[model samples]
Target chain A: MLDSLLQFLITGVTVGSTYALVGLGFAIIYNASDVVNFAQGEFVMIGAMVAISLLGAGTPFPLALLLAVMATVAVGLVLEALAVEPARGAPVVTLVIITIGASILLRGVALLVWGKDFHAMPHFSGDAPLHLGSATLLPQNLWVMGGTAALVLAVRQFFRRTSAGKALLACSCNRTAAQLMGINVRRMMLLAYGLSAALGAVAGLLVAPITFTSYDSGVMLGLKGFSAAILGGMGNPMGAVAGGLLLGVLESLSAGLISSGYKDAIAFVVVLLVLFLRPSGLFGKGAVERA
Target chain B: MHMRKRFFGLILGAGVLAAGSSFAADPIRIGTFLTVTGPASFLGDPELRTLQMYVEELNARGGVLGRKLELVHYDTVGQAKEAVTFVKRLIQNDKVDVIVGGSSTGDTMAAIPEVEKAGIPLISLAGGVEIVEPVKKWVFKTPHTDRMAAIRIFEDMKKRGIRKFALISGDGGYDKSGRKQVLELAPSHGLEVVADESYGNKDTDMTTQLTKIRATDAQAILNFGFGAAPAIVTRNVRQLGITLPVYQSHGVGSKKFIEMAGEAAEGVRLPAAALVVAEQLADSDPQKKVLLDYKAKFQAKHGEVSTFGGHAYDGFFIAVEAIQRAGGTDPARVRDEIEKTRGFVGTAGVFHMSPQDHMGLSVDAFKMVEVRKGNWVIID
Candidate 1:
């Protein structure tokens, strides 16, 4: 029983780490602009797909990875410039809807380019499993969990330490006040989107080996990440990470202990319970008036 | 006045003769509705291609029953409601004599009532036993049902002397039906299911379920699912280092599954239509010639010849043969001829239709194939 529990935890943490990375992207964008970027998942898909296509074309793995990340970042910036920026000062709900539209458009383009076949990426360091007591872990699982932790820490430091990150936080807190203080709010928004896109791409690249990717692979991942962000505390990057891991672990345990069929249901029920009890989320602060 | 009436009668007689001549030379219309451009496009796109290619080929060879074939098709985009609407249009607007389409079970089931009402024969390409079992009078499917696949896998297990196994399935319609069939048929085969687990359609990881299965004393594992999930399950089963034999349903028969699963798919067994291993079949095998001929013709035009296209091939040829045997496009006669299909060599199997069996295929239609070095090799 203990061994099975360990196995479940291992699987959960690995799965959750991907969700954490995606959730982090959601949290960052939500903080910078009060719009939930529904297209965040598409960023994950684009990252992996671009890398796969590049690798298929005989490019080396490392170069393909770098180019794919760069391409995804460019797409993020483009999305903000064309879709988000043009609708600046629009209602948050409308902006969210625009992101949803952008996601559909991105998915459509991906389908046209890649067709409707699932593509596999060779494991980063081979597919040999690492044994831990009675449990086994893939080298790719380590990449996902470690990569997510490092990205989370880096994002936290960016918000807390860097001047540009601080400026972005200022914009999130109050755009007019930040502008008054000579902060280029638009540039900060662009940076936030770029950083978020980069995070999403890295998650995709890490998880692609474990889960084969197609054009619309990101839809489910994106939703899970969104849930993780909401569960952790919508705008808190660190909370989003925690929420993602927590959600993954919960799903794994429930699936292991109760039933695999009810895994998603059980996890989402917990999220719903959390929301009902604490509307601001597990780590979110209370709502404050700004007038 | 009498002379004017005679002139009118002469004109009427000329009009009747012209209509009668045109009727003899009129093309026989075969209506199709497939999920051509959606998520399930993988199944429908090839099916539509096969129908078009064969219709063209048949017409080139002087057509079926001395009349050219006209294929009137619509893209359902994997929608059941669209399938119903398209079937109605085919029956009412196009006034087609026969229908041979419906790429998925949902679409096929939805279109059944309309075809039955219109008294037109429909040969569906979908893989649900419900489409034929309990037998709809106007409906017949060409592909082997999920139930037959389950029975085939179980029979192989029983023959190998394996009594206990675990089943991991996806929650989709196809997978759920397959899982249900396996469980329902296990006891009759003198087999016991030690563990049964399921995963969501879009789940990326299935290690937890596999881990749970590992704790069980199951002698082997059978995965019943379609799409990328089965590959993931296969990878996870290997990753956990559980060396028990793995079996998959026919849903993963295509080479794409092997490509996605990579080396992990080696030694994994599944029951698939003979079309998948066409080149590997012995010379004496009856389906070898038909399979090779269809594969070559299809590959010449469109790249790969999936079993989906093969289903369409069987469906089209069966309909065409029935029309020829009927000696006309009479709806009732054509339906009876399709039911009377016996010893008909096609891509799927040697179909033998009876009043009780609309699909006209048994478990023998599936050849037990194993993934050997990333290619399918027939084991039985």
Candidate 2:
């Protein structure tokens, strides 16, 4: 029984780290533009597919991974320049729809380019499992967890220690004031998009070896990441991590204990209940009156 | 001798005229709806290509039964709704004499009621037993059933004295049928299903499910998912370092599964049609000649021979034989003739259709195969 519990927890954490990465992608973009970019998950697919194909073609793993991240960063910039920038100042709902459209288009293009087969990559480290008493954890899980931590720390450092990052935060707070302060708000938004895409790409490349990657896999990843973001209070990076981990643990526990069939439903039901009790989410700030 | 030569030439001229006039009549129309362009395209594309190749060959030989064979095909894109719409279009608009399609069990089931109402002979490529069980008069399908596949796995496991088993399947129609079969058939085979878990079809990670299975004292694991899920499960099981014998269904029989699974697929076993391991089939096996011919022809034309495509080959031959036996392209006659088909050998297996059994395949039709050095080798 203890072994089972430990096993589920390990699996949950492994999957949670992946969700955290995606949640961060969502959180970062939400902070800058307040447009829920539904195409966030495709960044993950792009990263994994590009890296895997390059690896298949005999490219060094490190170079292939670097190229994959760069490619996704390019995609992120292109998405902003073409889709988001054209309809600047549009209603949040319309921008959201544009992102959704972008996601569908990206998914279709991926299906055509990558074909419909699921691809598996060899683990970056080895496949050896570290025995943790009753539960054994894969090496890839460590990569995901470490990568998530590093990204979170880096984002935190960027906001607190960098002038550009402070300007981005200022723009998120008040675009007019930031522009008056001589900050380039548009460039900050572009940077946010690029950073978010890189995070998603890292997540995808890290998780692909364990979970597998395919063209349509991003839809579920995006939804789960969105749920994690919402649960973590939307735009809060720390909240995204917490919500992602909590959701993953809850899902795994339910699947392990109650029923695997209703695992997804169970997680959503909990999230729904949590939202009902606290409308702004677990970590979200309740309505604050600005004087 | 001169008189005999003149008589032969006259007879040949008369034969040519008869053929030419017959060709002038309305052609026999056969419509197909398959998942030729979506995630399940792996199944549908080859099936469509094989059907097209066969139709072209038949047309080259003056078509089937004195009428030119006309094929109207649709890409269902793996959607059940698309399948139904195309089935309706095939019957109502195209006015096709017969329908051959439904690459997936879900699509086939969705199209069943419509085809039954139209009373057209519908030859399905999916392997779900429900498509034919409780036997709809107009519905016939090729390929072995999921129940037969499950039973085959159980029988093989029983022989090896491995009674306790773990079952992990995808929550799809085909896998659902497989799960049902294993649960229902386990008792008869004197086996216990120690653990039964399921994952979503598009689920990337199943280590959680595998972890649950690992807790069980199962002597072996049976994975009943289709597409990449089975391969994912295999990888998870191996990554978790569980060394118990793992078995998969015919769903993972193709080389694509092995490719996706890579090193993890090395020793995994599965129950699949002989078409998968045709090269390893014994020369004396009854299906060797037909299977070899299909593999050669399909490879020659399409550069690869997918086992799923064999379902279409069997379906086409069954329809043609029925048309020939009925002596016309009338739907009712063809439907009746198809019901009486027996010992009709094609790519998947020798089909024996009857009024009671629309899918004429039996458990014996499946071959036990295992992955060895990234290639499928016949085990039984």
Candidate number with greatest DockQ: 1
Off by over 4 Å in 1: B1-24
The residue-level lDDT of candidate 2 at B168 comes to 89
Question: By TM-score, who's the top model here?
Answer: 1
Query: For residues B5-53, could you state the per-residue lDDT of candidate 1 as single tens digits?
Result: 0011233335545665322477788999998887888999899889988
Error of 2 at A70 (Å): 0.7
Off by over 4 Å in 2: A287-291, B1-22, B37-41, B75-85, B299-304
Which tens-of-lDDT digit does each residue in B1-380 have in candidate 2?
00000011233335656676446667788889888876678888899888888887776666777777778888888889888988998899989899988998889899999988988889999877788888898999998888888888888898889989999888887788889988998989999999989888877678788888888899999999888788888888887788999999988878889988888898898898888887788888788999999999998987768878898999998999999999998899999989888999877788888878888877889999888998988777
Report the Cα RMSD per candidate: 6.5, 6.6
Query: CA shift at A59, candidate 2, in angstroms?
Result: 1.1
Per-residue alpha-carbon lDDT of candidate 2 for residues A80-181, written as tens digits (9 for 90 to 100): 999999999888899999999999999999988987778888898987778888678878889999999999999989988999888878877777888999
Interface RMSD of each: 0.7, 1.7
Docking class of 2: medium
Candidate DockQ scores, in order: 0.78, 0.50
Q: After superposition, how far is residue A203 of candidate 2 from its true place, in Å?
A: 0.8
